[model samples]
Target: MGSSTGTARHSFRRRFTIVVALVAAVAVACLLPRWWCGRDADQWYRGDPATVRGLAEEMVAFEDDDDRWRAGGGADRVVGMWGLLAHQMTALGLAQVSLEHPEWRDRYAPVVTRAAVKSLLPQLRSEFTSSWHGRDGLAELDSPDGHAYLSYPALALGMARLVDPAFPPHLAAQHDALIRAFERRLLASPTGLLDTFPGEAYPTDVAAVAAAIAVHGRATGTDHTAVIAHWAQQVRAVQIDRDTGLVIQRMGGDGRAHDAPRASGTGLAAYFAGFADRALAEELAAGLFDQQRNLLGFSAIDEYGDGHSGAGDMDSGPLILGISMSATGFALAPARAFGHREKFTRLYRTTDLFGLPLRSGDRTRFATGGVIGNALLLAFLTSGPELAR
Candidate 1:
């Protein structure tokens, strides 16, 4: 009986050892690609010009084909929004590179110009607005009835002008008009927030409007100091969440919170605010950083701050263990902008691990990231001080 027991024990040990080895091998298989892809993650935040150039070149190539954006199984509104975001982000990224590295200005100016123009295409706006609001977003831009989303394209136009002062005269005029319209409406609003759609006021979109005005001022030497300052003051007074210190994700027209303060909105708001108000941007960044989670050297921003928990929606993307995909992704820009080296590196490693980067000669694109994802990554990775002057 003792001999039989010993043999059974030995058999059990052998099986356990084999299971352990299999588990270890599987772990290595998963981690090896993450480590390999993320080997140079720091190069991105460190402003390696060659790294920036490669991604920028890839974005330009992708944007060159308008037909590449097709309405697939997803809703047309979602696809259109992605297409618009893709173009706006591409322009912003290229413009930022031109501002930071003047040596590349000549090569990227035309690309920036093309992206800015494409963002304003009526068909694109119609596709998005018809599905979302049952009307065109670009229509009646001068009306104060809340077309706050237009601020994105306006900001792109302003960036294009900043990069190439010789921007076509007509386009330059349109940029001026947009700046004036935002200024007039913002100054006229009692709560200092504008609705992105009817009855839907998002502080993030309002932040973009302020950024658009500020960039337009820089590009044209226009004085929007009063407008920006007033908007910032109002934001601090009403739009910020008392508990989290982050901007409220969604607000009513009266600046009342419609949803929780979330990292996705806060991170993007910080990126937009960086162009206009450094202090505001930094404040938002600090709040956002407080919500970050680090595990095994990988960092992700939680969608909700401490004391808040919520399910994922369209804005937050999928939530994995409460970590938000959009929040984590959007946080990259502010992480780099605010000089969070460790955080940026870890977050970027996470991105590289999941992004599945595939490289060709002088070009690299993330296999999982289509045109919109790639463009947004380029923008977030390249984000720095506008005009770096």
Candidate 2:
């Protein structure tokens, strides 16, 4: 009886080991694709120029569809906030693409640049439509002193200058006017920042506008050193979050910093701030790194640095295991820009796994993301040297 029991136990052990081995094999098979695909994070950054062009081409198509949605399907089809920001970033991406591949100007000028100017520029201007408010309600984009609409105009026009010397002279005139508007807004601000929604200013948006002004200066051989110095000082004085030491999310026009640092605003502001003050950009990025960095396998950013989940908004998108998806995705731009290669690589890998990309013919897009998401992704991937003087 004892011998029989021993034999039976050996047989069961063999079966158990076989089952364990099989399970292990299956797991490896399932996980290998993700590892192989994502092992090299820079793969996305090394995209073909033609593919980059296709993203811009595809964006125009998507924008038309969005307009149609607003016109026919749902009054709620309106895009706002981050969506509008992507509209501006898309145009900025196209501008950078045109600059990097000057030989492709023939294709870029009319297809990307002019199309962007015609469609998205007006959207950013918010002509009778609302971009700062919710989709259900049309909030006018008419903050005279510190309007958010003013940010992208400066960015798109400054980028337009890089696209072609023959870009319309009137556009350049418009660029100067926008800069003047920004200057007026800056001088008028009690807090030294510009507002996106009325009475609410975000450091990220203001930093972008500041960078655009600097880019325009470089493109036009005009010096904006004095203005930038004053503006940067104001930002430092009022925008830094005491807890995290990075830029805050929203400040009142009366100058109260409302939220602690997060990946979304800090990343974007830092990327653009590099144009005006690389030092400031570096400082913010360093602070962000100390607060947000998660170095286990794929890098992730905590939505709030001090574990404070103060409030989650559409801008933060969905949080994954306490990490903000939008913050992680959007932060890729500045992270890559500032030479945070290891972290950038990990973030890009995460983006790739979650992005659900689609590729056909010459075009590649993230299936799960809308026009804004893809546009922002394109902006992150195709970023090149600055036009900054």
Best by TM-score: 1
- Report lDDT (CA) for all predictions: 0.82, 0.67
> Can you give the TM-score per candidate against the true fold?
0.87, 0.81
After superposition, candidate 2 runs with Cα above 4 Å error: 1-40, 47-54, 60-83, 115-144, 187-190, 291-296, 385-389
The lDDT, on a scale of 0 to 1, for candidate 1 is 0.82
Q: Pick the candidate with the highest lDDT.
A: 1
TM-score of 1: 0.87
Flag regions of model 1 displaced more than 4 Å.
1-37, 67-79, 131-137, 386-389
Q: Ten residues in a row with the worst lDDT in model 1?
A: 70-79
Compared with the true structure, what per-residue lDDT tens digits does model 1 show for residues 184-301? 9999887889988678889899999998999898888999999998888988898888789788889989877888888989988888989889998888888888888987678888
Clash count for each candidate, listed in order shown: 0, 0
Model 2, 207-272: lDDT tens digits are 877887788787788887877887788877878776776677778877776766676677667667
- The alpha-carbon lDDT assigned to residue 379 of candidate 1 equals 86
- After superposition on all CA atoms, what RMSD does each candidate show versus the true structure? 4.8, 4.9
Q: What clash pairs does model 2 have? A: none
